[model samples]
Target: MKRPLLFLVACMIAQLSFAQSKDEKAVAAAVENMRKAMIDGERTALENLADSRLTYGHSSGLIEDKPTFVEHIASGGSDFVSIDLLDQTITVAGNTAIVRHVLHAATNDNGKPGKVALKILLVWLKEGGEWKLLARQAVKEPAK
Candidate 1:
């Protein structure tokens, strides 16, 4: 009887772990897709991920409305060579998730390589079985 109980517990634990891992993967993939859309200047894709009540904050102490952000990314005004994820942490609680990330990015600005290190926090909420980003804040790392 004891052996059977222990085995059942082990199975439950394994199943829970697997579920959590799947959730994490889903979140990661969603964020990666968002990043790719932005880099590829796909405003429509980025817009789809954004919540209607989005609050976006940027490292330059600027805040942008959802439409403005989409327009900016889609425009050729800012060119990105690469945007790499350095590290990320995601915590899920029921229908909400918070993601914190560090990114290494390079862009084209005035014919110069505009290198930036950024820390970002994104809050997502599940709406109708889809995750939408409700808020996002990014802070630039101080020049070293």
Candidate 2:
């Protein structure tokens, strides 16, 4: 009986650990959509996902508003060939979500192939039942 009870408790805890909240699920989907859009350089998708007041920061210390960010990404000025987000965490508070992840990507910025590894922090806001990227900041990835 004791062994059965312990096993049941362990199963419950494991289920709880794997479960995601509703908002967390939405945020994760949005993050994946953005990743795909970035790699594809979809201007309309990028524009739709970003809030009107977006503030995007780069690891190279460049900061851009919504228009600039969208344009640069869409025009291939800052191109992403492939993006892999690792060890992501999402926290929701009221209408805002804060997400952090390690981003490793292949890029072709201005026709030159390169790779980038960054630690990314992203803020998303829910407006009219849709999640939009409000802010994002990226920094150099820490050595492992």
lDDT accuracy of residue 131 in candidate 1? 81
- Residue-by-residue lDDT tens digits, candidate 1, 31-116: 89878886787878989988888888988888887887777777855556788987788898888889999878788754467887
Candidate 1 ranges beyond 4 A from true positions: 1-19, 109-112, 142-144
TM-score of each: 0.80, 0.92
Model 1, global lDDT: 0.82
In model 2, the Cα lDDT at residue 53 comes to 98
State the RMSD for candidate 1.
Answer: 3.3
Best candidate, TM-score-wise? 2
lDDT of 2 by residue, 78-107 (tens): 999999999999999989999999999999
Q: Relative to the unseen true structure, what is the Cα RMSD of model 2?
A: 1.6
Candidate 1 matches the true fold with a TM-score of: 0.80
